[model samples]
Target chain A: MSINLTILGCHSATPRANAFPTAQYLEINNRHFLIDCGEGTQRQMRKYKVGFTKINHIFISHLHGDHFYGLIGLLSTYGILSREKELHIFGPKGIKEVTLLQLKISQSHAKYPLIFHELTSKESELIFEDDKVTVRTIPLKHRVYTNGYLFTEKEKPKKLHIDNINHYEEIDRADYNNIKAGKDIVLSTGEIVPNSELTLPPKKPLSYAFCSDTCYKPDIIPIIKNADLLYHEATFLADKTDLAKKTKHATTKEAALIAKEATVNKLIIGHYSGRYKDITLFKDEAQEIFKNTKLAEPGKVFKII
Target chain B: MSINLTILGCHSATPRANAFPTAQYLEINNRHFLIDCGEGTQRQMRKYKVGFTKINHIFISHLHGDHFYGLIGLLSTYGILSREKELHIFGPKGIKEVTLLQLKISQSHAKYPLIFHELTSKESELIFEDDKVTVRTIPLKHRVYTNGYLFTEKEKPKKLHIDNINHYEEIDRADYNNIKAGKDIVLSTGEIVPNSELTLPPKKPLSYAFCSDTCYKPDIIPIIKNADLLYHEATFLADKTDLAKKTKHATTKEAALIAKEATVNKLIIGHYSGRYKDITLFKDEAQEIFKNTKLAEPGKVFKII
Candidate 1:
């Protein structure tokens, strides 16, 4: 199990020539997902050479313009492209109304089924689950109702120990499925062979956490504990702690503190305020508390092996 | 008076890298106006160095995503920048509901007053008039209710013929105002001087007509007659005349034909369909019918001096 994340945009607030707003493309367990599509995200996707049709699910953190303004344009483009795959959108309440209204008014109706999964719960809850992965909300504190998301790969089936299986003549090729399913093999001589002896353990499952536009909240540490990778919003530096608090945004140090408390393997920080001319300051400040911190940039990718 | 028009984006349908949707910045008679703000228009304005604060009026041709998707983002950015000037948005019906609903749902209220001039008229009518310029809607035929705009500079006062005015010492400096107003000058000796003898006519007024996303409709020739410059949408070439007619778009020949029949001084064609790889084909085709035809490109400027 592995996760690959591509940062389509990472700047805060309005989009500029060189700096884009928040948007990320994540590939986990062979499932593609788009998070927080800001304006110009489609262009960024095109620039980064991301497979446009690979994405079947989209998760929006909040309704801020910097977070989700590009949604209508992308949806309309999908309609223009005549996408037939059903798209599932997980976002806060009112996303459906606002999106459908624009499409209806413009008469650019979608050719595919648009399923909206409105999230209103303030508690951590499972929002999506498939055969290979599961996604749950990491309710976050912000100026408005918001939620972070935790994506995890489901545990795979046990691998067969071919050498051990060779010792049993009763274990035919047809019994390999049972062995992989953790079932014991009953010998024809009325002897039992343990499944543990016939099968080896599967690889460990990996998890990714995405948190943004939220204040410094330690309550989320339990939910994101021991994640393989965590992307958190660091809108300000330590010097702007007061401003960060007033705006309900996290500072670099605050984000590092969350990373430390959550014990994630690596931390990716972004959603930078445009005031800072040098983004290296964010990486330097974050590294002071979390050694495994990295700064997010447009088109930058992070992978968990 | 002069008209300086900056084409922010000119491609049709969807926005792509190096190919933006329809948006233009027009500076006429000291008035700055933004027309058809598609997605990424704010970034285009920033890239082209168009003064964001100078635009008080915005004209939208229709509700298509490629025509006006960037409006809400721009309005939100204006609020973020603490814009104090009232903004006037002129578009078709349902624009207000769609825009206001987004602001309401996102809670991104504008600090400045947002006035919406909903146009439902199917006839030519004056929509905006100021001290120096007047804007009138030229009802267009399209898939949706669309209207092109005509911006004309009001007639300026006659310029004083300094050498001729000195011929009459009795015509004091105080009489200059009446002379410029095209009134006969009354000398101190009660001798009347004809206004034409004391003042020269002012520079000829300049007018610009913006027509986009419309099929060939000759009826608009009367409204846009003798325009100094005309921008018409030429989505396809003459080879795709059938497709153009079916899509309610105009071909290169059709746009040039309109420019020729309307007797406009110059013709600028844009909104090129993505199917054409070489935009020069549009210009070459248009120039075949109109000698003074120009192709609209991103950042291309057309001026009437």
Candidate 2:
């Protein structure tokens, strides 16, 4: 019933002494998902105490080395650990071939089913749905084919009004299920107690959107509108706006602009360039545009409410 | 001249919290070479303070994930760092295609030239040679095509006998180079001083051999014979001899036997199975056959005499 995120690594392309590349672990509705596994992600997972076996689905934004180089090592470790649970991987086209080729050359065959779901759509589309949450792909513009993911919690059942239910002596204990399901209870006296009188409306469902390694594009605002939380990559500060545009990456101002225009409740910025040792400038610049902006540091956890 | 080896990573297969996979850095004859770059090798290099730009030649024994999964990440880091030096990579066949395919898929073109030398021969052949050192392949028995490398220091110039030079004042200082080259020196009095009397023999050229992930193959003894140091993979103890044979891995006893038969000055055993947490047992088992056996631990350095 809660959405939690753990930042395994947040630095850009190369992993250095204390800075790691991009990797995040999201836990929502009792399920865990790994997003953008860069090199040393497994070590980061271990360092953060994220359960490696709990990661069943992996979502990759693109085929960049900083995003997907750790994939083979992770898979190899799973094989070495003799993991039997099926693992689902979703990414752009050519990921499957690239993964399989590495495995073939390394002579490593995974004991678990490494199911891959290739994404190639240019528009926002639902990619996964379950009873607790729904996942959709937010097509992104980058140097390569990329995708950002939108995770939204499903509507929860109404909260039971204990005092109202206690007043209904005619309602059996077995009828509680029906009351929680938004149904009225029928009494033996032929009187109907409205469900609204016995139960209160559930809280608003929360949603989180992840966007990384993309240029400034207002087209994604509609797809991620009204999200409870949004994570965007800000590789450079405002001064490097031209460099960001040339590299097809976003600046802090651009990321904040997207978050502000989309009306997200809170925004988290990460994927800082290694050249910038101090990240306070990024947060300061981003906050100028979106006051709710936060820096995504490694091992930092955020709750989406 | 001296041959120094730094063990960057020594564990086998999967990288763990403190135990990394196989990677070793060798500084021989004023040249740096990286052997078996496993996952997190760049981080290990940083941790051990090994100069990154000094490594120009990389030798990979096989395509196993534990051996070469870190290559792409390292190459990407080099690109990000704007390294313009050409890197020479030597590995088994299919390495070039695999490396290039990953680069193509990731869209990470190296700024430096990544020249590849695909090795397919199974016989003991000279793979590389320079004025300082000569490298040859030691055919090994493994699950796939594998080769162990032998690095031998080329013969050095004889050391001038300082005291003897002072006695022969008539021998011009310019003739010192000729004396060091093992030529007889003639004084102004026409007295011939034999090369042995004028100059001492050059310190015996040192050599080191690396054999890993292979079974007990006696044929490699001749190639590694009289090596100053030999690093052989001892994946299991004597108790797991059956498993070693089945998996085509060598046991501690087998590695010791090979070292003893090859007459190596020192034997370093590594690539331990994760099951054995305490590696002292491997050293003990190896020392029973070869007295000069040593354990290869992360960050451990071995000096070859």
Which candidate number maximizes TM-score?
A: 1
Candidate 1 per-residue C-alpha lDDT over B1-305 given as tens digits, one digit per residue, 9 for 90 to 100: 79999999999975567788999999999999999999889988989999999999999999999999889899999988999999999999999999998888778899899999999999999999989999999998999999999999999999999999897767777887888888987767888888888888899989999998899999999999999999999999999999999989999999999999999999999999989899999999999999999989999999878
Worst 10 residues of 1 chain A by lDDT: A13-22
What are the clashing pairs of model 2?
A: none
Each model's lDDT comes to 0.93, 0.91
Fraction of reference contacts reproduced per prediction? Answer: 0.59, 0.71
Give me the displacement of residue A296 in model 1, in angstroms.
1.3
lDDT of 1 at A198: 98
Name the top lDDT candidate: 1
Please provide, for model 2 over A1-305, each residue's C-alpha lDDT reduced to its tens digit, 9 standing for 90 to 100. Answer: 78899998888886577777889999988889999999888878888888999999999999998888989999999998899999999999999998998998988878789999999899889988889888999988999999999998899999989988899777767887999999988788889889999998898888889998899988999999999899999999999999999999999999999999999999999999888988999999999999999999989999865
Docking class of 1: medium
Instruction: Work out candidate 1's RMSD over C-alphas.
Output: 1.2
Misplaced by over 4 Å in model 1 are none
Q: Provide chain B TM-scores across all predictions.
A: 0.98, 0.96
